[model samples]
Target chain A: MTFPESNLRRKKLGQALMFGLARAISYGIVAILLLILFFIVKQGIGVVNWRFLTAMPENGMTQGGIFPAIVGTLYLVAGSMLFAFPVGVMAGIYVNEYAKEGPVKRFVKMMTNNLAGVPSIIFGLFGMALFVNELNFGASILAGSLTLGLLALPIVIRTTEEALKSVDDTFRQASYALGGSKLYTVRKVVLPIALPNILTGLILAVGRVSGETAPILFTVAAYFLPKLPGSVFDQCMALPYHLYVISTSGTQIEASRPMAYGTAFVLVVIVLIVNILATLLRNYFGKKVKMN
Target chain B: MRLRRFTEPVFESLIKISGYSTGFIVLLIVIFLFKEGISFFNLSPVDEGSSLWVHNSNPVKKLTAPQIKDIFDQKITNWKALGGNDQPISLCTLDELGEAFTEEQLGAKFERLPACIDSYIDSLPGTIGFFPDKQTANALKNAQPVQVDKVSFSKFISGTEWFPTSRPAASMGVMPLLLGTLLVSFFAILFALPLGLAAAVYLAEIADERVRRILKPVIELLAGIPSVVYGFFGLVVIVPLVQSTFNLPVGETALAGSIVLAIMALPTIITVSEDALRTTPRAMKEASLALGASQWQTIRKVVVPYAASGITAAAILGIGRAIGETMAALMVTGNSAIMPRSLLQPVRTIPATIAAELGEAPFGGLHFKALFALGCILFIITLIINFLVERVSAKRVR
Candidate 1:
């Protein structure tokens, strides 16, 4: 063999290049993220005060705060959870616990996956056609929330099934040994153990519905409103829709830039909070799982 | 025991209802979309405004499709272009024609309709007033019906212009929109695939445990970031960046949209590919390392090859996200419904077109159905991709 020293030197160079390449790639992601966060924060930090959060918008939506948008998003999140949580959790439990391993379960899973893959804009159309036009909901929060609730349903079912499956088999067996009915055992024993994980799923669903813009654009999002909505029938402004309007189609693009950035920052913060909560819950549940 | 027996069937039926309702909604959405959109494909003049005909006193009784398009598009501004006497053409919309008739007067037979039509045509010698076929045949007099062609399916597919509100006719071609969608999504996948794959490699085979723990959540957070936020970022940063870099008039271009979508696609690609890399059999990597291969060599030669299908799945999923993305593309792409020639040119995507125009399109109108048709196309494309992803992963399992 020719000169081991040269071969070793070439190998060292190869290793350095590869490791450096890997490090650079990781750093690239971090840098892109940091740039997005910092840029929005720097541009919008001036507008994120108490008045901005609390007051209603003014002047062709060029000035003032997005208070109704905040309340509207909260209302949407609550409405979607009300519809999606119970149905999704029940379906999840049925598929995981009651239904036997066979074609029916597989079909349900496949359908859920397919539904999840459908573009949100298609949901917007469907929502408009079904809820706004056919059902005569007439472009209100009720229609938008139902559409978004459908969007979130697949995620909830998937997560709930996963959470229920993570519960130990021994607990169920003991319940059965104590003459507990299948339904009784599942209601008290299985659900209690799966509750935290289910909550995690609901939190994630909240994050999803609150930020969605396309489905609500046609069904629910109002162009501008000076006052807060009194009922679900009324159309209301939302943060994502408000951000979209000001940034793209605002009458005065330059003047509205500050508000656009602020809206983005608020949206990012909301999503991040929900994500952090879900992550913390997941980790805590995971650790408890390992301990048990 | 009696209570348990009574409650068991109730719980069972309730759970069954919930489980089936999920599938039912998917069915309902598909049916509703198809029901509303299928009229666009009909050969008959079933679509409203499709039966509009031009009535004029000029010698020209017949016109070709291109001639009609040119006249409404303002290319044929003068009457001499169609072999008529040298005079300017006066175009009147259906609303003006309908405005002449009172509601009670139009209930049965023509009262003042013939006079209204004669006066309208007589006022301007080279006049072209458009009215529906029913109104022209039965309700009007002294005005000749100009031979008009239906807006055929072929014309809709291949026609370059998309003037849906053009007077005397509405051009409903979707070629530019389809092309723009393809262009932006293609560029997005081009930019995102490499970076996402590289990041996945680092996380899967190179990063330490501590780094993995921290970066994993960060990547998930990236995915959790809303599409609207990404659209905002594109508007504020990438739009200006592209404008300055390329020396273009405006920052909103196909290039700007692609850049934003590429960033959005990263988390999906990275997560899927990392999972694929992690699933590579440990023995394959150990064997490669034992055979005098370096850690990077093992990763490149053995791990990646083993996980090739997964990486493909990731790429397809990323493409799906790019195509389906509406809000970000709408914000950044200049919303011009023209055929895209360059990445720097402003273009409109299908989803963007729908979101932007659907609000103004009257219910059950031709323009309304056309947007739904665009939605149908988007649905079919994403459905195919989902099937491919499912098939690929299913094959991997086998």
Candidate 2:
């Protein structure tokens, strides 16, 4: 009886030890994240003032603000969304609602996955080859937007498919019962329900596009442009690429360290805010879908 | 009604066309990569409009790019070593030829430069001269052009050096960059797997509902942080820490890259593996408990085994991301294009190489094509990884 009790106690102790180890690991991962955020914010907060947000860089980018990069990023994001949104959503609709479960659907899904997996640098090369060279777009906003739009396509498509899948089939059936055509039913019933979730995906894509540096490296990002881009055909400065330049390749790497930190802080803030917004939107609509 | 009838088919076709565009775009990427990359093999390793000339009596009539580089760099100094008569190898370039003759001796337009080059080669049995092909074409009387093989596939793959800007010939050996990429990714996965697995288990099984709710989104946010920021963090924090702790000259080593990549890969591994663990049937766990097993034992023996495919997928996806990761590796890996010997050494990855060099490589030039070829290699690597993930996850579904 004593031996059996000891054995049981040993098992219980082992269980507690393993559980505690796992919990510690989980917390440790979270701690690392918090540390990164804290370190950046602490180091960068001094440089992220009003002038930093609104003025053009000065003194070889060792001083002043990142306003043009911010505006350029906004332009790239909007332009990419303009291209990727409709195509990705329509592709998702066709795949989920119309295309039969067959090789064609499977092939498209595989392609999307492969596209997502294709490193951003490859996209840069392809963009350089096709858009920049073959299409004669030069290293302008047009080429960068197209490249980034392609990068975001798979994300948008996957999210739209998931959102559309979540809408109840009875909603579609009800629309059909009222003599609505397939397109009408989808427009009236399916899209209205899936719009918020789809928007969540679009917002996340925007975050991704704004943060991406590699795709824009050759396609559009300029080292420095004295004046803002006057049109879509012109090259422009971007936030992520600017951060990379000032931190790694600038003439005043040490002198501009403060600016690097400040840029990183703003970029992180933008991405994190977008992520939080996406999460909130997802949760709110997720609850609504369940309640309905 | 007629207008609606006409528009319906048009709308349907538009949707169908959009659906097809994804695959079409992927196809276009492959086409474009090959279109630029395949031509690299057809070009000579030597600079355009330049050729290497050797004495007529020298037995080594042909040389590969690496052999020529080695001979010029004095790594191979004996003619006998290169299948020639016993003699010391001598290298002559345009500047060296200029040193041999004055402007008055060569002529005002340097029209006598080619004759001067030929006679210089004639003076030394082991001499190899590098000059423009146009200059040496009909001018060399006693010297013969060494037949340089075009860039071969085997040489490109196995050659260890990566000097794309070397004179006379650009050394486009991809081995060092390939090894560096694999080395960093291997170490990253090594660091990430255990931590990611443990965190995944906690999120899937041990964590309370409230903790899971907060932790999950936080992890997603971790993934959302731009890779460039990670690179910056690695440069500022990890690089210095590595340098001081190890007492090294530089902190931007493969070790720094691995650490950053590991951190970046963790979220993907945790999220995927947690989802897999959650899918372990509740009934299966109950059955194990009914059989007098502890919760930990049930998890270890039953839940983990059930989710093994998913965990494998997670690991592969993480590795794929690590391999393809560019900006961070570029920023922190020190960007040295040498064969990496240890984690402490700075290394250059394929993506980083392309990112750094593509700007300087002239359009439609050999260097540009070589970078495109690197892109092709990256494309294939990720392609294989994606295929493997599909296989693993598909097995779970079945």
Write candidate 1's Cα lDDT for B253-368 as tens digits.
99999999999999999999999999998988999999888888788899998989999999999999899999999999999998899999999998999999999988887788
Native A-B interface contacts kept, per candidate: 0.69, 0.77
Candidate lDDT values, in order = 0.85, 0.93
Poorest lDDT segment (10 consecutive residues) of candidate 2 chain B: B130-139
Worst 10 residues of 1 chain B by lDDT: B43-52
RMSD of 1: 3.7
Q: List the residue pairs that clash in candidate 2.
A: none
Best by DockQ: 2
DockQ of 2: 0.86
Which stretches in model 1 have alpha-carbon errors above 4 Å? A1-12, B43-67, B77-128, B132-144, B151-153
Give lDDT tens digits, candidate 1, residues A1-292: 4558888689879988988887798879867976887787788888899988998887777788989999989888888889999999999988888888889888888788888999999999999999999999999989989999999999999999999998999999999999988889999899988988999999999998999999999999997887888999999889999999988885688888888888988998898899989988988987886777
Candidate 2 error regions (>4 Å) = A1-3, A289-292
Q: DockQ of all candidates, in order?
A: 0.71, 0.86
Error of 2 at A105 (Å): 1.0
